[model samples]
Target chain A: MEHYNMNLTLKVWRQKNASDSGKFETYPVKNISSEMSFLEMIDVLNEELISEGKDPIAFDHDCREGICGACSMYINGRPHGPWHANTTCQLHMRAYKDGDTVVIEPWRANSFPVIKDLVVDRSAFDRIIQAGGYISVNTGNAVDANAIAINKDNADAAFAAAACIGCGACVAACKNSSALLFVSAKVSHLALLPQGNPERKTRAMNMVAQMDKEGFGSCTNTGACEAVCPKEISIENIARLNREYMMAGASADK
Target chain B: MKWSELFTSSIGKKWVMALTGLFLIIFLIVHAGINACIWANDGGVMFNKAAHFMGSTVVIRIAEIGLFLGIFLHIIQGLMLEFQNRSKRKKGYEVPMGNKGSKWYSRSMGLLGTILLLFFILHWWHFWVPARFIGHEELTEIEINGVHMHNMYNLMQYTFQELWVVIAYVIACISLCWHLIHGFQSAFRTVGVSNSKYMALIQNVGIGYSIIISLAFAMMPVSMYLGWV
Candidate 1:
């Protein structure tokens, strides 16, 4: 790729805390390299702000390589910029050109309130996981890895669903602000395996109940969540989740 | 899970949508088939007989009640879901991402449903109210094979004669087309048919169903108004 430099304007959201009504503030950066990651470009802008005796824009980021699911910027009206199946940190500044204006905002959902500039409290996801995102463990001896014989296709799909990084992108991208994709991914990740079978019914029931209690909206099958997910979490998992929930609801003793 | 959760929970709400949506899908097929009777072009003989049978039978009458109930449940639950979903996002984005993440119709179900509701009101006023309440005293009473019934085919002809009504029905059918295009596969997905093989088949079948049903409906009015029937 040919390296180039460009000047750009960024309109970023600024919020003091959860209670504060946020607004966008624009700033210009000069001579930004196209090779820099989107987060690195923001770092340069932040350094400039700090030098000018201003509050630097605070955004969440870790493992800039894209696995951590920490970076959650809604860049240019997309959860992770315009790239398909890419994370915000992995997005390159080359996606833009000279004199371009980029708009960046945090994930906007009632359940995930904005804690500060570009960082919303995503612990709601944590609570949902706490509800039932686990399988029972026997504390004594380590079991053989080959003990559980799994089918190859289901194992691959389970692996794919497990790749969801707990990012709030699916919620951010959904028109309803629904967390179904996240919950479904979590559900499918475990439900496909025999180890996850014992708790499967309660897991689906409780997680969905917790998700609803968090005030997240219901799924409308709009496909937006699948489109914006950085981990390429398939909406097929959502259907599987629905199947699990329905069967559990119908047959579970509780 | 408790039985009440089927009505009160989020996934439960989706089950309601899926079930009611499927019911309505079946209703549309029946409705479109009946409407296609207009193409028989037999001077309203066969059309009025079918319409009379649908209106007068006891079992069909019971089923009509269920149909209305299904429609009401679909509408009420749909609107409530739309409102709850809207409230989940307190603040709006400055730059709207229009149709990049999902198709416009999928996102605009609420708006399309509202339009369909309005069309339903007009349609009921024009056809159903007169047929059910006012009796054949208002419509021209005619007999076919010793069976006397309301001349509903004449009423349809009269209703479609107005250029504005024809246009409105065409627009409503267009909206229904888009609504069903998204709704058909979505209903199946909600009902747990997420396997890739079946989903591919459902998606194609859904597209065909939407186009064919809406076209059949739209043609009823267009052909009547243009004297093609």
Candidate 2:
């Protein structure tokens, strides 16, 4: 493949803080390599802004390899851009052409408030995880793999559900701003395991309760979350979450 | 933790929507089946007889209350959901990828529901009030095997004869098709039917159900207007 260079117009959301009313600030980047990742393109832009004696745009990134789930910027109208099953950091410049205008903004949901420019406080996810997205198992004693016989299909579903990186892309992509996909993925991964049995009764209820407490919208089953999900987590997990909630509610003494 | 939380929470609100929505789905099927009897072409006697039994039946009369409740709860929850969803995003994208992002109906459920609401009011005024409250004395009442039945068939014929009413009904049914297309599978999904195999089955059934019910509904008025039924 021949190496190509393109000049692009970047329209980015600029906010001084969560309290500040934000606006789009446009800048022109010249001679950008086609092979650079989307975040890398932003880096180049930031470097330019810094050299021009201006404050660099703030965005979040830890594992640019698409593992951390930290790089969640809504490119254009689609979350994580027009790419499918890829995060913002994994997006390449080749998806765009010369003279194209790229609009970038942070995840838009009341639950995930904007902390700075492109970095929103996704700690709501953390709060959900903390709210019973776990299991209690004794450690320091290595058990045989055969100790727990897991079904092949259930194991695969668990693994797939576990692939959720806690990124807010699912929320960003949702039309209703629902977090069912993310919470369901977390719930499914644990509920499928024998170890997750003890808390299974309260897990879905508590997490969903917390999700509502955080002011996230309800799932309309639009599947936009699954469509934009980097891990391609099945909406099946959401069903599992609902199943868990129903079971918990029916069995709870209260 | 409280019992009320089940319907108060976001997930709970969805449950309310799904359960009430499923009830309406069943109601539509029954309503459509009964309305389809107009095609019997037996001087409207059979249709009116059946309508009288349904109207006089204690079970169905009680069910009418439940049906209204279901519709009411569905509308209330749907509106609340719409408001919450809109508020969740205080700011929307300047360049929205509308259809590219998701199906238009999925995003427009609120609008469709509102249209259906107006349709419901018009529908009740045209049919229910006369049959139940105002009395259907003006129309001919036919007695079948000593059981008197309201001449709803004539009422329907008169209602559907007007082009404007027919057009309104046809438009309402189209809105209903979109609503059912999203609502059917969505209700199942909300209730936790997420397996790939089951999801596909439910989606297919949903599509078929929407098509049949919508076509059945829209065709009634069209058929009446054309004097076929």
The TM-score values for the models, in the order shown, are 0.98, 0.97
Candidate 2 chain B worst ten-residue window by lDDT: B135-144
In model 1, what lDDT does residue A11 have? 96
Checking candidate 2 for backbone clashes, the offending pairs are: none
Write one digit per residue (lDDT tens) for candidate 1, span A56-82.
999999999999999999998999999
Model 2 / residue A183 / CA error / Å: 0.3
**Per-structure clash totals for the candidates:** 0, 0
Point out where model 1 deviates above 4 Å: B136-138
Q: Where is the poorest 10-residue window by lDDT in model 1 chain A?
A: A15-24
The TM-score obtained for chain B by all candidates, in the order given, is 0.97, 0.96
Off by over 4 Å in 2: B136-138
What is the C-alpha RMSD, rounded to one decimal, of candidate 1? 1.1
The DockQ-based CAPRI class assigned to model 2 is: medium
Per-residue error for A115 in candidate 2, Å, reads 1.4
Docking class of 1: high
